[model samples]
Target: MIEINLDVVMLKRHISSKELAKRIGITQANLSILKNNKAKGIRFNTLEKICKELNCNPGDIIKRIS
Candidate 1:
């Protein structure tokens, strides 16, 4: 399974979803989908933008588990 780690990062950074959404130039609703791992697919462009804004790599956000 692919797990999304946004909650961990958010706790670590003490950043709110609203702040991240504003900083990333994405809507809160869209961010909620991503944060909740309800998104079926993500664009590479969006990933790049997120990584840039979050100052972290994809590995930091995604974890693979059996």
Candidate 2:
């Protein structure tokens, strides 16, 4: 399974969900879905925006697990 570590990175960056969502040009609800690992997939454009806003890489947000 793929796990989203968005909440962890956000905390490390001292950024709030609301701010991140707005900066990434995505709805708070959609961000919540990603943060909570309820999202089935994420667009590359959206991922790029998130990485840009957080100053992090895709690996910092997602991971694979057994």
Candidate 3:
């Protein structure tokens, strides 16, 4: 399974969902879905924006488990 580690990075950066949503130009509800691993998938452009805002790589926000 793939795990979305968004909350970990958000906590590390001390950013709130509202702030991140505004920064990434996404809705807070969408960000919440992503944060809680309820998202079915994410666009690469969105991922790029998130990484840029959070100052982290994709790997920092995603992980794979067996």
lDDT of 3 by residue, 1-66 (tens): 999999999999999999999999999999999999999998999999999999999999999989
CA error at residue 44 for candidate 2, angstroms: 0.3
Candidate 1 residues 1-66, lDDT tens each?
887888787777788999888987889999899989898877888878777877789889888889
C-alpha RMSD of each candidate structure in angstroms: 1.2, 0.5, 0.5
The sequence of per-residue lDDT tens digits that candidate 2 reaches over residues 16-58 is: 9999999988899999999999999999999999999999999
Worst 10 residues of 3 by lDDT: 34-43
RMSD of 3: 0.5
The lDDT for every candidate, in the order shown, is 0.84, 0.95, 0.97
How well does candidate 1 score on lDDT at residue 62? 83
TM-score of each: 0.85, 0.97, 0.97
Tell me how far the alpha carbon of residue 45 in candidate 2 is from the true structure, in angstroms, after superposition: 0.4
Ranking by TM-score: 3, 2, 1
Q: State, as a TM-score between 0 and 1, how close model 2 is to the true structure.
A: 0.97
